[model samples]
Target: MMNWRSAPLAPATASQTASSEHADERIKLSDEQVAAAQIKLAPVETTQLAEHFLATGTIVPDADRIGRVAVRVLGTVTELRKRVGDPVEKDAVVAVLESRELSEVKSEFLAARLTNDLQQTLAARYKMLWESRSYPENEYLKSRLTAQDARIRLDSARQKLLALGLNEAEIEELPNLPIEELRKQSLRSPIKGRIAERRVDLGALVGREGQESELFVIVNLDTVWIDLAISPTDLSKVAENASINVTAGPDGPNGVAKIIFVSPLIDKDTRSAKVTASLDNAESKWRPGMFVTAEIPVPGRGAVLAVPKAAVQTIEGAPTLFVREGQEFVARKVQLGHEDDNQQEIVAGVNAGEVIAVSNTFTLKAELGKSEAEH
Candidate 1:
């Protein structure tokens, strides 16, 4: 709340006298009084005034930030490291499974590795003997070819292990692990996020026919999407990369979201285009399924003469603005045009580069009313 102080109307200036037609509507006050009344002034300028339409939307997790934790091999859930709502990091192991299918692959890799090692040793010895003429050239050649074949098999087996989700470090450690642990494999998250859903329990059989393939679903809520349905009439006004203001509800999270997607096809039943906006939610104040309202801005005519919405006051039911002329302020009736939340287009009665009272125009209106009463 602001305290309003009344000031005596000063003598009219030459410009005010020139505009004698509006002399009665002018209110005068000293610089000290203007400062005390908290009346701020700004230059009227040319800017775009966009029209807006409201659309209902819902908050949801960003699809690109979602992660699924699953395994490729047939396995039994032996351990669950995370539950619903637990935070997880990228590549973090969230669970472990025991799979005979995985054990068979590991065994093949180990056998190929051992055979390649033995063949390489034998090939090297045959080379040395051949160099000294102690071994036959044909025998040395046979040994060398066998080693080459063994190397190719070893590479193939290693690739199979990689396809089954074993990392380089895990495959290297396979030969050192005891035989009993050969069947164990870990499930890791592909993204840093929180566990949104846990579909498996300990001892549950997964990765089989008619069984759940995903063990957990993780979502990063640092950013979220507000899905909106735009009517066909306003779809032309909306475009990708534009911004919309969104409010979850009364007393709920509110933010300006960037339009990321605008569907080309409209729904047959609703006749509305699906639009989506990306909003930063680092605070995590918003959640999925929360209903929100979005204010989409319709493209406006290029730059036009405009003033701040605050500068326009309703005097006796008509929109008015106080233009600062010389040392006094004069109430000028103006014609209004397209307007958005902050700016109102002035189709008439105002010109660019003229300084006018912008904030606290109500005080000037009060002073004008008082002057009228005095007259």
Candidate 2:
């Protein structure tokens, strides 16, 4: 560390010497001394300083990212492939159900398929005989019509299987499955997530009237929502798409998030409006129901003279900043107006285009304290 000492200056005039003895707020440091002391300077410029409002919120899973595995047909849960908190992929089979209703549909499809094949064979034979004049045209027409009706029935059966949650591939492969497995249907997750809730146990009957049809609740924690409660007084400062910083306890920073929603109506009991923000949780660091603090930037009044946060120092209970006047640095008491995380608005005691010490102002404060002690 470089040692900090007051730099010497040339002799002052009579009035200057008398003024220096009166207040003695100035500390003179040479160019090399300033550089060695690591003192940096910045111009007091006009900037839009956004004041922030504090609000509390809880982390929750994004509503759109949550998925549910539910059954449509009456069935008994035969197997569960995933338990609560288990990770799952999109379209992953999470559970299996055995249902007599599904078996009947599968059987109907098989019957229709067999009849269609038989009718098609007979229709081909009848067409050959009709072309050879061995069979009447009317008989051949009836045979072809029967083949068409069989095809229609097969299509209807296929549709029924689809409505019962069978995909095209599954329905196409139905004939190859054994008889015992015919009643079994696999339930797949609609999204890639972790299972949040499991509502059914093995052998539990689902899809019955007045019974729970849902099997598992899966949530994608890649992104989450922070529901904030904004009071009525600070509601005007909040706007959609505004950015904010979120922190969960003392576990470092959770990064920035954008405001996605703000409610127009305030809650009567809480006397606050609801605001929502979306935070990226791809690391799985944040979870639902975790309490977090959010810092929201309030709208700035306009551009005003401002200085870096480091430039301001507290001396004798007054906010002080060191302003460069010619070759000397003078401490001036400043009246602060509004401030954000980076800047503090200088409402008085400073002007635009004025140079001030922006870094290591505490060194200047120490020197000022030392000078007063000498007197």
Candidate 3:
């Protein structure tokens, strides 16, 4: 990288460095004036320009976070607490029910618990009697067998209560509650989320049966999916785990998300595959159902000599760059190469370490045009 800041170039060599312009086509502005115009300068160097593929898609609810909530026991809603769009915590009760069927289940559990206690007591007593020779061996064996039968029945009853949405803690508390409170069951959300839907109304009968069985739909919108549609032509460019930037619209929500899913199969009609990314939306600003434009970076071909995109100015239909020469700025046209959103490669006419006008290149271009017209 040679410094382009050496002695002032003669007319012949200066023209050779530019795009076939006269040897002296130049624009000279003072550093103070350049600062006033907000013109900025940067050194040209070889840079890797990562290409990108643009696609449009929509934000959707994370499928993993959406929950379909229901109760296992048949019940009638007696007290409805939550409504659609209401936020809920994990295990938060959404509705209370008065279930006659549940009363029978609780009664069965209670009876089995009592029987298990009695049988265990009997088993202990029989073992004691046999060990002390107060009871015959056959008699103790009979009592032990009866106790085992009662124990098995007790375990079956506890399992049945569990299947009916009773957790171990609830089952333990069941024996402490009065019979009247035993039938009172509540439907709770298993996850922390907003209630997306409420399928049951107050006094509505709910059971473990048909489609109406599901009572609530809870969704965690903190993290969501942005589905980017990739055309088959660009399918080879998109891959899983690639970083993508998504914007809903100008002045709307925008976020950086990583591509976590790329569909293997393409839609027959649209001929496009769905590429998905996950973005954190803890603020709930990026709502579901929002259409978003995604910029997915395509892998680079290789490293090349590049310049800032802002440094290149269109002069008389030619891609011209202002090369810094001593105290003056010389307008030089350069061959262009691969370009991306931020940087464009300089295929020819410019070398690494050469200083160029990065900001306000238009003002320099106008001055160069005026200089040429004078000839």
Ordered by TM-score, highest first, the candidates read: 3, 2, 1
Tell me each candidate's TM-score.
0.77, 0.80, 0.84
Per-residue lDDT over 146-182 for candidate 2, one digit per residue giving the tens place of the 0 to 100 score: 9999999999999999888888989889889899989
55-164 per-residue lDDT for model 1 (tens digits): 99999999999999877888899899999999999999999999999999999999999999999999999999999999999999999999999999999999999998
Q: What are the Cα lDDT values of the candidates?
A: 0.89, 0.88, 0.83
Report lDDT (Cα) of residue 237, candidate 2. 90
Predicted model with the maximum lDDT: 1
Off by over 4 Å in 3: 1-41, 209-211, 300-302, 325-331
- Cα displacement (Å) at residue 303, model 1: 3.3
What lDDT tens digits, residue by residue, belong to model 3 across residues 1-375?
222233212232454436545645665555655666667888888778978878999999999999877777778888889999999998888988877788888888889889989988998999999999999999899989998998898899889888888778888998899878988987778889999999988888888642357899999999999988899899999878888888988989888999999999999999999888999998889988999999888888888888888889888788989887765687788999888988998889888899999988887776566655555
- Residue 338 of model 3 has an lDDT of 83
What TM-score does structure 3 among the candidates reach?
0.84
Error of 1 at 152 (Å): 2.4
Whose TM-score is greatest here?
3
